[model samples]
Each structure stands twice: as C-alpha cells, then as structure tokens.
Target chain A: MDEFSFINSIKQSTYKQSTLLKGVGDDAAVFRQSSKDIVTAVDTFVEGIHFSRKTMDPFHIGNRALAANISDMAAMGASPVFYLVSIVIPSHWTEDELSQIYRGMQSLAKQYKIDLIGGDTVSGNELTISITVIGYAACGKARYRSTAVEGDIVFVTGTLGDSIAGYHILMNPGQFINKNYYYRRHQMPDPRVAFALELEDLQRVALNDISDGIANEAAEIAEASGVSITINYQQIPTSDSFSQFTVNQQRNWPLFGGEDFELLGAVPKRDWPLVQQAAQRTQTMVTEIGYVDIGKELVYLQEENGRKPLNKKGYTHFKQVKL
Target chain B: MDEFSFINSIKQSTYKQSTLLKGVGDDAAVFRQSSKDIVTAVDTFVEGIHFSRKTMDPFHIGNRALAANISDMAAMGASPVFYLVSIVIPSHWTEDELSQIYRGMQSLAKQYKIDLIGGDTVSGNELTISITVIGYAACGKARYRSTAVEGDIVFVTGTLGDSIAGYHILMNPGQFINKNYYYRRHQMPDPRVAFALELEDLQRVALNDISDGIANEAAEIAEASGVSITINYQQIPTSDSFSQFTVNQQRNWPLFGGEDFELLGAVPKRDWPLVQQAAQRTQTMVTEIGYVDIGKELVYLQEENGRKPLNKKGYTHFKQVKL
Candidate 1:
C-alpha cells in the first residue's frame, strides 16, 4: 500500500479523544488543553538497540514504545491526553506487520483514553518508533526530579527487575521455564499513571520513573535535588518471578537492570503516612527503600557488609558496555 | 559519550523559552500554554531517502528536519512555541557531527523564538531525525484545508520549483553555475509562519503547505473542501534561478516537484484585497494562480489550448517513481 492508503488504514482503528479537534489528515493536529500546565515527553525505540525482531512481536514492539513515553508522563504525575507516533519501517516488513504494530499501539492508547492525534511514517533501513506523549496537570502540581528535600523518605511503587529478567528469558527462551510472567512484564510494562496522580495529589517532594536502573535514577534525583540518597540493598522490591532467579541475578537486576517503568519518589518524613494511604487508595504497592540526606555524593548503597558508592550507570547506547 | 553525558551536552546548548517550566533533566518537559488551542506536527527525515550524508551537511539536515515540521504548523497559522527532536544516529558518526546537527537546529529554533524542549537520541544503522513541533493559535483562528468555498481565489506564497531545482543543483554541483541560491533554498526552505499568521488573521478559506508540490496540495484542498480548483499553467510562479532551467524542466518541476515548504491557500474573492493587504503588511509575496469553483473534479490545469486533468501525484516513499 502507498503512504496515503496506509495512513487511512491507521485512522480507521485510531481512538480519538474529545480534546482532539483535528487529527491525521490536516497539515497538523489541533487539540485543546484544558489544564493549567502541559506535560510532554518523547522516547524512541530502535530495533536491535531496544528490541530485536527475533525476540519481539510487532504488537509488543508498539506497546513498549508507547509505554515508555507514557511512563515518563506518569513520572511527572500527569494524565496523558494525546500522543503522536513516528515510525520508520524497514523495506522487508509487510503492510500486515505495520497494521499489527498500530493495533498494538491502539490497544494501549484505548486503555489510557489517549487520542492518537498525529505522526509520520517513512521508509528506513531499520524499524524505529518515536512516540511523544502530551499530558496535563494542575498548575504547580506536576512533580519534578529536582525537588527532594533533606529528611525526605524515598519510596518506589511496584516491584522491579522483572523487565530485565523477562528480557533475558526472551533472549534465551530455552534456558528458562515458565517465563510468561517475566516476559509479559518486559513486553507490557504498566505505567503508574493513576498511582502517580494519587502521589501528586498528596504533594510528593520529587518523582522519577525508573527507565534506567534504580541506582541511576536515584542518583539523578539526588544530584538534581542537591542532596544524597542511601538505599538498603535488601529493602529493594522485586517480584516473585524475579526472586526465583539466582541471588546474584536478583541483586544485580534490581540494582542495575533498567526498563522497569516503575515510579520512584521522595516524600517528607512527616507526610509518609499520607503517602502510604494514597498508595493504598490507588491499590499500588509502596516500598520505603531509601532516604534523602544532606551530602555531596549522589547515591550510596547500604549492604549487609558495608556502605558503598552507587555508580550511576544503566543502558548506554553506543559503547556496548555494561556496568 | 554515554546517553547521560550526551544528554548533558544537549542541555548546555538548548534554548529554553519563558513558557517552559521544566526541560531536559526531568522525566518530562513542562510548558505553559496561553493560547486557546494547540497545533502539533511531526516529520521524519531519513538519511538516504530525504537526504544523503555525502551531499548534505549535518547542519542542513537538522535544519531541514525542523523546518518541515515548522512548515506544517505554519500552514495551520500557528505560532510555534517549542519543538522536540528524536535522532537515531549511525555508530560510525562522531560526537562533533551530532553536536553540529544540534547547533543547526538551535539556529532555526532561535530564529523563531521557540525552545528545544525534549527528545530522545538512540543508536541505529542510519541517521534519522524526527521532529515534533508544538505551536499555538487563538481559538477559531487556525486555518484548515477543508474550508475552501466556491469563488475563493487560490494563492501561493513566493515562487515554486526553486527547491527541486536547487536540489538538482546540489545533487550535481558541477552541472550548474550560481547554484548557491537554489542549493540554499533546497537545504533551508523558509517556513512562512509569520506570513501564514497574517493570512489566518485575514480569515482565509483554506490553507496548506506545499511539501508535496503545489499540484498535489491544491488537489488536497479541493478534495477536502468538496470543490474544484483550476490553475493556469502559465501563471505558476518560478524563481529567477528556476527560470534559468529549460522550459519543460521549469514546467514539470513547478507541477510535480516536491519539498517546496511554501504556503498555498484560498481567499474569498470579496476578501482578496484584504488578504493581499495582510500579505503586504507581513512583507510576503503572494500570487493568485487559481480559483475554487462549484464542481467535483478536485483539480484541473488550464493550458493554452484547453483545460486538462491535474493528476494528484507527488513524492511517494517506497515507490521510487517521481510524478
């Protein structure tokens, strides 16, 4: 199919939100923003770099791409209203494969009540999907990574390390048994949007989503907030599926493996109880993994043996080196 | 550089507008919107397809990519507030080359007083730049392609065919003398944002950007508005550089060549004088080349002997065939 026909097919299955005034066919998409502030984030998923065709289905590829961006908005405690997706498809891919990708995106968009408003599709050597999500928040309420204060209690929502463990299982399917739980975690990460909104309403001090590993993201919050963070390695949350792995694998995965798409934030110690109540209201699991203190070093890990500096490293694009 | 350091480098050079509440380091960028409506457009430039590394500089590539999206917003008569760029670079490329590309984008963003808000950079097999521009317009002011009326005068901003001619010159540098003007036009087609805002203020019936050639765009306007548009072949605008080419080349290029990034719209004949006055105020050159009439044929070309059907074909990816 040609570009026009392909776009028409996409439009047929696209979900339109009430805020979208014009979509698809116009020179640009027009939408109305009713909130006091606009929240925007963009993430690009490259085949082979982010996922491999051999390991991932087209549906999962699309779902992961949009989920990555949605997670960013959730990190800011915003409700995503619309999103635009730009896909670069390889020549060998069939039209049916492309439609499947769009269907995958449509499914997630429907769940979030977000309108697929605009995008561009082009031919390229490798498949790459870039998604930009536009969201809304109340004025002065959107969470920021740079707002943590001394004595703030660091908290994380949901379990971690499942994504990386799932990725490994998908990479070597024969090596693991009953990998569906981990695989689904990797393929369809649930962005903590509703939970984050509850946190925002409770007025959290700082927030960030763990796209990178917990170590790297905590370091970011620490550096941005001009404070230091210390986390007890034993206190880190991990799923039952992840715990089934070897001890070393479980430890390394929660600390350094990225793409968890879980929320990490800080709340004043005095407000910790209220924060827990908010999490309960949202039915989100909350774990107190660390605390913020006045110091220069960004992050530290308190293990059973001793305390050590936490290296802020996760996935690096070009170096092809793991830390 | 790793992704963190690479992102830091971009943060140092990025220009932040006053409306931006947060940028870069946060999970998402936050910006305030004062306008009643938001306009968004996205365009992707693939290395070999939209350009070639051997012929075009990284600066021009970045400039062109952002310009394409800006032109889309301009077509809707929106004032661009900010833009996000997602770039996938080949591993063989150096850090300096990527920095140069960002600098190129910065230059244009500065020209329009828009912020480089948020984006993603990943490693891929080919250089691909996808830009999403966010603009704003007063409620009920943004123009649409589906609003043209019978007796509306179809108009085009500036001369056409220059971009394609310039592209030819760039492709074969030694074949043409005085190629700089055309080459620059091809590399950096000015997005008529200011002029389009003026036209919109004058309440033009319809508007479109000529990225897909005037013929195809006019046909789009006609199809969307359910009216017939007719243009005199002899009246088509061509720059002096374009006129230096052969008659057939000039004729065909103006009709079928794409990537002009010019504006095309329709003004009701009664408001034609007012629209021309608005263009004059904006110091924009506009040529009336056609009229919208009550018919179903979409588009027609008026030749010296007789009128003929104007085929709606332009640059279609994957088909390698030029209309």
Candidate 2:
C-alpha cells in the first residue's frame, strides 16, 4: 500500500475516549484534558545502538519503543491516555514489517487502554522510532525525581535484573538454559503502570521508571533530591533462576542491566503502608530495598562486605547516551 | 559538553507558564490544562531524506523542524505552546553544531512564548530530529481538514511559491538574482500562528497550514471534506521576485513547492470579512484563491486558458515520504 493507504490501516480500532475528538486523520490530534495535569515524555530507539534484528523482531522493536515511553508516564504517577510515534524507516523495510511494528505497539497500548493518537513517518538510512506518551494526573499530583525526602522508604516493584540476565541469554543463544523465560523478560516488559497508578492517592511519593538499572535510578533520585540512599543488597528481590547465574552476573546485572520497565519509588514512612497495599491490589511484587537519609548526595549499596558507592553508570555496551 | 550538562544550559530562561507544574527534570513534564482541548503534532527531519548539511545548517534545520510542527498546530486553528525535541546525533557532529540546533528551537520557542518541556537524545548513523508540539484551543474549536463546507470561500495567507524558488537557488548557487529573499524563505519559515489565532472567534472556518504545497494541501482538504475546489491561478499571491522566474518555475513552484508555513483556510462567505480583519490586524497578506463546492472530490486550478487538475504530489527532490 502507498503511505496514505497504510495510514488508513494504521489504526487498530476505534478509540473509546470521548475526549479524543480527532485521531490520525487530521493536521493534529485533539483531546480534551478535563482538570488534570498532562504528563508527557519522549523515547527514541535506533537500530544498531539499541537493538539488532537477530535478537528482536520488528514487532518487539515497536513494542519496546512504546513500552519505554509508557513506563516514563507511569513513573510520573499518571494514567497514560495517548501516544504518538515518530519513526524513521530505512529504504529496505517492508510494509509487513512496518505493520508488525505497529501491531506490537497497538497490542501493548490495548493493555493500558491508551489511544494511538498520531505520529510522523519518514524515510532514512536506519530504523529509528521515537514515541511520545501523554498521560493525565490529578492536579499537582504527578510524582517527580526531585521529590524524595529524608526518611522516605526506597522500594521497587517486581524483580530486578531479569532483563539483563535475559539480555545475556538472548545475545548468546544456547549459552543458557530455560530460554523462553529470559526471552519474554527481555522482549516483552510488563510496564508497571497499574502499580504506579495505585499510589496516586498517597501524600508523599517519588517515582522513577527503571529504564536505567536499579543502581543508576537510585543515584538519579539521590542526585535530584539531594538525599543519600542505601540499598540493602540482601533485601533486593530476585527470581529463583537468579541463583543459577554466575556471581558476577548476580552482583552486577540487577544493578546495571537496564530496560527492566519496573517502578522504583520513594515514599514517606506514613505513606509506606498505602504503597504496599496498592502494590498488593495491583498484584505487583513490592520490596523495601532501602531508605532515604539526610546527607551529601550519593547512593550506596549495603552489600555483605560493606557499604560501597553504587556505580552511577550502568551497562554501556548497548546504550551510548540518553537524556 | 556531555548530554546532561548540555541539558542544563538548554533553557533560554525559566518558563513563564504557571500551568507547567514541572519542566525538564522529571520522568515527564507535567502541565495543567485549564479546560482547553489539546492539539499536538509530530514532525521528523532526517539527514539526506529531508535536507543535507550543505543546503541547511544545524540552526536552520532545528528551526525548520519546530516551525513545521507549529504550523500544523496553526492549521488546526490552535495557539502554539510547548514543544519537545528528540534528536539522534551521528558520531561526527560537533558539540557546537548540536548547540546551534537547540539555539534555533529555543529562539523560536521564545518568540511564541512556548516552553521547552523535555526530550530524548541519542546517537545514530545520521542526524535525525523529531519534534512534538503541543498547543491549546477552546473546547471543541480545533479545526480539521474534513470540515470545509460547500460555498466556503477558500483563502491562503501570504505568497505560496517562494520556498521552492529558494530551494532551487540554494541548491544551485548564484543561479538566481535575489539570494537573500529565496534563502530566507527556504531556511526560515514564519509560521502563521498569529494569523491563525486571530480567527479564533469566527463562527465557521476550516484551515490547513501550507506545508505540502498549495495543490497537495487543497487536495487533502478536498478529499477529506468531500468537496470540489477551484483555485484561480491569477488569484494566487506571489512576491515581486517571483516575476523573474522561468515560466515553468512560475507554473509549478507556487502549486508544488511547499514549506511556506502559511495558513490555507476555508470560511463561510459571511465570515470572510472577519478573516480579512484578522489578517489585516496580524499584518498578514490574505488572498481569496478559491472556493469549495459540492461535487466529486477533486482539486483544480483555473488559468487564462482553462482549468486543469492539480497534481497531488508536490516537489520530490527534498522530501521522500511524510505522514
């Protein structure tokens, strides 16, 4: 199909939101924001830098792109409502592959009830997808990275470091046992949107999505809020398969193996019970891994040996730069 | 500079909009929408596909990217407000070039009183910049291409053909007599946001920003609204330098050479006076180029000899595909 016909077939189904007056067939998409703050973020994934065709299909690439941006909205304590994708296609990309990419995004968007509002498509030398996610939060209630306060309990939802372990198994096939488990973990990240939304009623909370690894995200919170953090290594939750990996993998992957799409949050002690209740209601695994304290801005891991500063830089082989 | 520090120096000044609760240092930018419908669009510019470093510099490239999106908002009869830029940089680009590119966007954002919210930056094989612009219009007032009605007076603000004329001169240097006029027309587009916003109170109006040339844009309106359009060739406006171009240039450039960033609107004959007053107040030159009629969906241009079908596809030298 030509580009216009392709656009006509782009939408998977009619959207349910009455606020979305216009979708794909206009100069711009129109949506009414009824008394809420809009939270939006953009994420880009390039072919060679972020992924290769050998490990991920076109569907997964699109899924991964949209998943990352939606996770950003979840991190801000907002209910994701709409998304736009701006993609750069190489000359060789087939329409079928393009369709698979969109299908991947639509499938994930369906889970969150998010509308695929509009986007831009262009031809270039490599496949690059940038997704912009817009969500709504109650007035002045969206969480921020710089809002972590002293005495806040630092916690995370879901297991940490699975994506990195999955990454290792996928990159070097036949090197690890139980392939499907790791494959799903790396390929299809379940964004922690429901868990993040559950905590919206809490009075004091700070959240950051784990696109970067746990250690790096903690450091960001520390740096942004001017608070010290200490994550107890033993308290960090992991899967049963984590024991089968090498010690180096166990030590570093959970800390630096990014793309986890989990929520790392900090909440005051009075709000901790509410956070825990929300996690339970959402069926998410919650673990109290650390605490915020008054000190110089720094993040430390409380390992068996002693307290050691967490490396702010995560795994660098795949990601070169991000902001 | 590294990406993070570059982000620190990004803002020209702290944003003035109180509705923007949070700006750059969060998981997402948060803003309160005061009962207005949100209008948003995404536009991407890729190296070689859109423009090369030879024809346009980094600043002009950034300016062009944002201008295109802003014009999309204007086309929908919305006021341009906030913009986010996601850029992919090649390894060879200098920090100075990247900064200049941002300087271009910041300068334009300043002019429109728009805020620089947030974006993603990454590395790739070639430079790619995708911008998402968000604007607001009164509830249910956002216009669409599908709204042109029969008997509406079709109009356009400003001259149509300068960008294509400028593109030729810039590509083949010293061939044209007036260099600056054409150069500025191609490099710097004055988005018709002011004139578009001026028609806010009009009872019935339809608009489209002139990005895909007058012919293609009108065809879109014609096809979307299921109306026939007839544009008088003599009625199309042009600059003084236009008279010096070749007959073929004169014939095609005005209809096919896009990126003028002017507003093409359709309004009821009764409301035409209000549109004219809006144009006069904004210092924009308005022209009655055509009329919308009930018929088979098609677009035509009437000339001295007779009426002819307008080519739907515009100039193909610079742009390959856009949606």
Candidate 3:
C-alpha cells in the first residue's frame, strides 16, 4: 500500500456519504444545511506535544483530536455536519497504526453522525493531526462567551481533571489500575453535541467546552461577557479519581492542567431549572458550579475563609512545569 | 503566564487588519464577500508525514500550506478572500518559531489580498496545521475537476519539479553552493490566483492545481472528467534544476513528487492563441502539455518514442519506504 492508497481509503468512504455534496476530491467539502451555515471550528493535535509517542496509542490520539474539535462545536450550541482532517505522519509508520487511527476516528464520527468529508495526508517530520469541524446553528441563537449575563448560573457536564489523571496513568501505568474510566476519559472526551443541538434555541444557554481546563475556559467566558464570576470551591464537580489526589494537587490540576474536553456553560437564573430539566430529558447531568456577577474579579468561596480572589488561569504552553 | 496570555500574545498581530466580523475571540470567524455570501475550503498539513523538519523550514511550511489551499480556490477561478488557520505546535517549541510561522503565513495572505480570520492553537505531539480558506466565485462560476472534454488542450503554469529539486537541495544543503533559485522555490511556490481569476467561466477551461505534481493531478482531472489524457514530454515546462537531473529522474520527480503547487488546466483548442496572449499579458507562461483523447490511458509524447504509455504512478503514502 502507498500513502495515496491510505488517504484514498478514507476518501473513498467519506466521499460517497449522502450528506456531503463535495468531499475528498474537491478543494472544500460543500454542504447544505437548514439553519444558518455560520459556524466552523478547527482543532489540531501534534504527536509528542499533545501525546507522547512513548505512552499514547495512535488510535486514542486520533479519537482524541476529533473529539476535542467536536466539543468546540458543541460549545457553540451547533450541530456538526461534516469535517476535514489533515494529517502529517512520520514516514516510518506502519499501515496498521495508520489504519488504527482512522478506525478510532471513524468510531467517534459514527456516534456523532459526523460525515468525514475530506482531509489531506503527506509525509512530514513528525506526526500531526488537524481537524476542522463545521456545524450549523439557527441564526442569532448560537452560543458565545461574550453573552454571559451578570446574574447567570454556571454549569458543567461530567467531572473535571480525570483526563489529566489519565495522562498521569499513561506516564506511570503501574500506579493506576482504574483502566476502564481513566482510559475512556482520555481517549473519548465526550463532545456533548446532542446537548448543544438541543440547546440551540434555548436563548439563555451560553456555552463553551473545556479544552483548557474549567477555570481557564470560565475565565474566557467571564472576560468576554464583561462580568465577574464566583465559584464555590466545594461545588466544583469531581470524579473519584479527581478527588483522590492531594488537595493542592487537585486544585492545581483542576484549575490549570487542560485537555479536559468537557462542556462548560452559563445560563440565566430563571432558566436554570428548565436547563436541568432539559438535561434530564436527554439523560445527561448538568452540574451547577457557580454564578456570574457584576464585578471586575472572580472570587472563590473557601470554607475556612469567607472569600478570596481566585487566580483564574489554565495550562500555559510557555509554562515551565506542569501541576 | 497562563494559557490565555500565551494565546493573547500569539494573537496580537493576527487579523489586526482584517475586517473580521469576529476574529480569534469567537467560536468561528464571520466575514462577508462582495458576492454577499461565501464558499470555504479547509486543508490540513501534518508534520513528519507531509514534510520533514530537517528539509523544510517552519516559515515555508506555514506559508506553503496556506498558499497550496488558496490555490484550490484559484483552481475554481475564485477570488481569494479570508482564511482561518489552526496550528498545533509541539510543546517544546519556542515563541520565536511560532511568531515566525505566523509571519510567513501573514506575508503570503497579504499578497493574495485575503484576511487571516481566526484559528485555534494548541500544543500537540507532532505539528499539524489546518487552514480553512473562504473565498468567493461569482455566483454561477466555480471551476471543478469534473468538467473537461475531448480535444481540450491541456495547459500548465510555471515549471514542474523545481520545488521537488528545491526540497532535495534543502535536505542536503551542503550539496549546492548557488542556492538562490532553489531556496526561493522551496519557500514560495507561487499560487496562480491572478491567473485563475482571469479564466472566468471555467466551464470553458476546467482546472485543477498541481499540488500533487502535474502527472498525478492530471490523472485525477482525467479520471474525474472520464477522459483520456495525453501529454507531450517536450512541452512540459522545465527549470534549470531539470537539466541537473537524469532524464528518468526528471520524469519521475515531475510526475510523482508532491508539493508542486502550480496550476493544471484544460482550455478549448480554439482558444489556444488567446491563451498564449493572456499568458504574455500576465507575464506567466502557459505550456501546452497535450490534449484529451478518446480512451482511458494517460499517455506521454516523447521526442524519439513519439506517443508512449506512461506507466509510473505518482507518490502514494502506502509505498514501503523508510523516512
């Protein structure tokens, strides 16, 4: 098999899908959507930088890249229609690994009903994966960070920092035996696509996905909306794996160590109950984290102390060390 | 510094001059063209698989990825408009390299009269770049690979294999002393945006760019249009680099090597004279390779052998070779 054969294997499958008007053979994938065709998101993952070749599996890397980008689409309250992927792999890789990566991507894409319209692959210095996801939303209804209200309640889906912990498990496999949950979190950070699609017309749900940890992403929403935020530390949801870490380590990881592809949202006070009910209808949890307020700074409610300024920051590529 | 700050520093100069409805801060970019609507194309480049860090500089890799995709719009005879780039850098890279890569992309974008709209940046293991370029073709005309006819004279812009030779030169920089031409070819393989825009109503002139070299791209156009192709080897435009290589090498490099981002087109035989005049007007040469025939084989006309079967296939990713 040759590189074109490998790329064509993917193209052949995606090109014939009914939803794609134009696919692998063309300059761009063209589609017709009922709602506004205004939203598109592109995300990239590099080997050694995003994943360790020594510890990470190619299948998981491919699945993770696709999932992370789709999560971005969900954050906008948009329904993803199609995607274009670009991959650069080291020339030395085997066909099996390449096929495994595609299989992983196909698995998630099937679940989301996302049509993999087109992508490019060529030889490069390292392995790289980039995916551009296009989604649709009703005009004027797509969510944005800039629209959060001063008195809105903040919500998050699932738990936080387990994906980071999964990385830890990969780095030190002997230390972790909770393979089922951590492995799932790292390989498949759920994109909340159905939830986003359902919330498109709700008007009060301002949404974003947690790519750069909860605190960092929340800070973006707060800054964009020109409002202060307050998080009750005790209320921040966590899974058992997350809770097992030392207090300072947990706080730091939860606050900064990103790559947590969870959905974070804000809703008006009046709509909170309705939003929760809506999630119940969809069979998903909507955990309340905190509230938005009219002020210049974010505050953390501590049990020992009344309140204190929270350092609202997340993973920095330039930072020297990790939590 | 935090992740947000890193993003802000990198976002400082990008899209500063763009008439972006919403730029990097938003979920997706919003832009309008004179045609009142838009068309988009997304292409991604992966490291170690598409290019070699040892052979290609970051600036050229960044610039060429953008330019090659823009050429896709050019093939549609579309005017360049706006682009969104998603870059995944290795975690170990420095700020200087990132800025330089963007600078290279921005420089090319400025020349093409397009805006750098919005993009997402993340740290990954291998470098991956995905760019979705949005451009406009007058409502009724966007050239496609599926439109070609018997007797249409095949035409190509610039020379083939120069970029390939340039890659070779870069991989072994010590081999050549007079590196000016090779260096330029490696860094900037011109996008025929102006030439493509000139050939309006591409129904009369089916077109595709030569990203995967002329032979492979021509085969694609032929296969898509259900037409047999014939190319005159003598008529294939060549550069000084062609003279340095063996005849077999010249043929192989021009036919199979990827990264030659030139334009491959088909125009009416009757318009041959006019095409020559237009080439002169644009100061870009248009070499007539061959024409469409009745059957399915892609043939080549050699000086001594007259018409002969062209059997060598172009570059394929599955070919077993060590990087």
Candidate 4:
C-alpha cells in the first residue's frame, strides 16, 4: 500500500477521545481547551543513535520512544491527554515491523488513556521516531526543576540502576547472572503518569524524570532553583538484581546511568508524607535519598567515606557504531 | 565534553511569551490555556526523501520544515502560538551548519510570533527535522476539510504552482529563464497564516492547504465532504513567470504541482463577498477557481478540450537518492 494509505489506516480506528474535536485526517488536530494548564514535550529517537536491533525490537523501539516522552510529561506532574508521533521509515523495514511499532504505541496509549491525535509518517534512510506528548496538570501546579527550595526532601519512585544493568545485559547477554528482571526494566518502563497526577493533590513539589540519571537531573534542579542538594548514596534504592552488579556499577549506575524512567523530585519535609501517600495510592515504590540545602548551585553525594561533589553528567547514548 | 549540555544549550533561547510558564530547560514546556480551541500539527522532513541539499541550503531546509507545519495550522484557520523542533543531526554536519538551520527557523518564528518550545536534539545518520506547531482558533471555529457542503463556492489564496516551479528551478538551475521568483517560493514560503486568521470572521468555510497541489487537495475535500468539486483550468491563477513555461507544464503545475502553501477552501455562495473583503483587507491575492456540488465523491477539471476526472494524488518528493 502507499504511504498515505498506511497513515490513513491508523486514524480509522474505533477509539476517539471526547476532548479531541479532530484526530488525524486533517491539516491539524483540533481539541477543546481544558481547565488545566497544558504540558508539552517533544523527543526524537534515531535507530543508530538511540536504539538498535540488539537492544530493542521494532516494538520495543516504538515503546521506548513513547515512554521517553511520557516520562517527560510525568516529570512535570501532568497526565497525558494526547500524543503525536512522526516517524521516518527506511524502505528496508517490512510492513509488519511498522505495524508492530504502531501497535506498541497503541498499547501504551491504552494504558495511559491518551489518544494518538496526529503524526507524520514518511520515508527516510534511517528509522527516526519523534513523539510530541501533550498533557494537563492542575492550574499553576505543574512541577518544575526550578521549584525546589531549601529544606525540601528529595525522593525517587522505583529502584534505580536496574535499567542500565538491563541495557548492559541486553548488549552482552551471557555476561550477567540475573537477566530477566533487569531486561524487563529496559524493555518496558512504567512512566509515573498516574503518580504525577496524584501529586497534583499536594501543595508543591519539584520533579525531574531519571532519564538522565539523578546526578544530571538533581543538578538541573539545583541549578535552576539556585539551591544545593545532597543525596545519601547508601539510602538510594535498588533491586536485588541491580545489587548483584559490580560495586562500581552499583554506585555509578544509579547516579550516571539514565533511562530508568522513574520520578526524581524534591518536596517539603511536611509534604514527604503526602508524596508517600501518593506513591501508595499509585502502588509505586518510594524512597527519600536526598535533601535540598541553601547554598550555591551544587550537588553533593554523601557517601560512607565522605561528601563529594557530583558532576552534572549522564551517560551518552549517541554511540559511534551505526546499526 | 559533557554530552548532557545539549539540553542546557538549547535552553539558551529567551522567549518572552507571557503565556509560556516554562520554555526549554524543563522536561516539558508548560503554558497557560486560553479561551480558544487548540490546533496542533506535526510534520517530518528527512534528507534524501522530502528534500536534498541541491534544492535547499541548511537555512532553507529549516525554514521549509517550520513552514510546512505552519501551513497546516493556517489550513485549520488557526493562529500559531508555539512550536517545538526535534532535529536529528548527522555527524558529518558542522556546528555552523546546524546553527544556520536553526537560524532559518528563528527567522520565521520571528515573523509568526511563535515561541520555540522544548524539543529533543540528538545524533542520527540523516538530518531529520520533525516540528510540532501548536495554534489556537475561535471556539469550535477551526476550519476542516469535511466542512464543505453543496453549492459552496470554491476558491484559493495566492498564486498556485510557484513553489513547485521554484522547486524545479532550484533542482535544475539555469534551465528556466524565470529563476528567482520560483526559487524564493521554494526557499522562503510565506505560510498564509495571517490571511487565515483574517478569515475567522466568516461564518463557515472549509480549508485544505495546497501542499499536495490543488488537484490532490480538492479531491480530499470532495471525498471528505462527500461532495463533487469542479475547477475551470482557465480560471486558476498563475504568475507571468509560471505562464512562461510550456503550455503543458503550465497546466500540470497549477493542478498537480505542490508546495505552493496556498489555501484551497469552499464557502457558501453568499459568503463570497465576505471572503473577497477579507482578502482585500489582508492584501492577499485570492480567486474563484471552482464550486462544490451534490454528487458522489469526485473531482473534475474543466479544460479547453473537455472535462477530466482528477485523481486524488500528488507528486512524491521521496527521490531515490541519498544526500
């Protein structure tokens, strides 16, 4: 079938959200304005740079692309309403693979209760997927990195370092002893959208998703909010599978290895209980690993040995090898 | 170098839109909702497929990417508010070339008064640009392709076929005597956004931008609206430079040539005067080209010889060559 025929097939689905006045099949998708503020984020993933057949299948690639953007929305304490995907497909990709990629997104959309409003699908040399996710939050309640203040307790939902371990195991299958749990962390990440929506009940919070790991994300909050942060390395949570990794990896991965898709945020000491209740309501793991302090923009890691400044850095996925 | 700085570098933009609570530094861009309905469109342009360096410079490529999405907004009779550009850069591209591309989009953003929202910039094998433009229109007033009804007067804004002819001139320089006008049309297309905003006063109308040429766009309206459309070939507007081409080229270019960025729409017969007044006020060249009638979904083109059925098709820019 022709390209237009393929794109048109997606819009003819039975699902249509009530808020969307128009979806696909139009020059632009139209939606009625809601009462809440709007949150939008765009993320692009290229085959050679972001994913490869070794680490991810077609479905996994698509799922990861959407998950990355949804994680961004959740970082802002917003619930996704709609998403637009623009994909550049190579001629070598079979139609089944394309359908599988779309099916992967549809599956996540169903879970998030978000509609695929519109997108552009075209031909290209490499598989490139860019997704723009739009979400909504209570008025003036959307979380930001700059919202962190002195005396706020920093926290994270879910165990960290597992996804990075999973990624390594995927790249080198036989090296790791425990694989399935970490592999699932890499293959399927549950973005904390429901948890973020629940956080809207609180008075205030500052959030950043752990896509770039806590070192980078926490530094961002410190820099933006003009505050200092100190995290206790011993208090950082991790799964048993992650703990099985090398000591260096156990320490480094949680701080430097990204793509965990977990929520990293700072809340007032009083609101920590509310956040814990929110996590309980969403049935998500919650842990307090850090606290905000009054100082110049700096992030320090408090280890058993001593306190050390953590550099604002994350692992790069832009590999030199082409897939 | 710290690779995490990509997000910080793009955060350099100092956009001053009041509605924008947060711009680039955050994981998601947050904006206050207005009274109008929101219109959103996403378009992807890939090197070797949608365009090549032969027909466009880096700046022109950037400009065209934003123009295509803005044109989609214009077709919906919406005023652009903000845009997010996700670009995949190849390693071969220099930093200056990348800056030039962004400058291209910045030039147009200045004209359209739209802020650059958050987007992902990553490394890739191809230069793929995916832009999502968000706009707003009067409540329940955004025009649609399916809004056309029986006895509506069909029309188009601005000269047709210029951009495609310009595209040809860019591809085959020195082949055409009239080069600059067409080249400018291809390089710096002024999306009819301002003109579209002026048309909001009208009671009812249907619009589809002529990115895929009038024949394809008209057929889309006919099919979507479940009406028949007939256009007289002699009445279609073309510039003197366009007319200098071969008679066959002149006929085919206006009907089948795409990327003119003109709006082809239908309105009730009584609203023709109102449309003319709006065009006059906006100082945009608009002309009557066709009319809608009750029939099975079909489009007809009238010529000196006879009338012929117009197919729902447009030229594909997916050339089989890598840049």
The candidate that achieves the highest lDDT relative to the unseen native structure: 2
* Candidate 3 local lDDT, residue B280: 78
| Deviation (Å) of B277 in candidate 4 | 0.5
Deviation from native of the Cα of residue A302 in model 4, angstroms: 0.8
lDDT of 1 at A258: 83
Q: Name the best candidate (by DockQ).
A: 2
DockQ of 2: 0.60
Q: After superposing candidate 2, which stretches have Cα over 4 Å from the reference? A: A175-177, A314-323, B314-323
Per-model TM values vs. the true structure: 0.95, 0.97, 0.84, 0.95
Looking at model 2, residue B213 earns an lDDT score of 86
Which is the better candidate, 2 or 3, if ranked by DockQ? 2
Model 2, CA-based lDDT: 0.85
- Ordered from best to worst lDDT, the candidate numbers read 2, 4, 1, 3
lDDT of 1 by residue, A1-323 (tens): 77667777777355557777887778888887756799998888888888877667899999888998899889998999888888888889888898899888988988999987888778788998888899988888889989899999999989888888888888766767558878888888899998888766566568889988899899989988999999988889987656568888888888888888999999899999987888899899999999999999479999999988899766665432211
**DockQ of all predictions against the true structure, Cα-based:** 0.54, 0.60, 0.30, 0.51
Best-to-worst order by TM-score is: 2, 1, 4, 3
Ten consecutive residues with minimal summed lDDT in candidate 1 chain A?
A314-323
Which runs in model 4 stand beyond 4 Å of their true positions? A175-178, A315-323, B1-13, B175-178, B315-323
Cα lDDT of model 4 by residue, B70-104, tens digit: 99999999998899988888879876787788889
- TM-score attained by chain A of model 1: 0.94
lDDT of 2 by residue, B238-287 (tens): 88878788899897888888889888889999999999999999999999
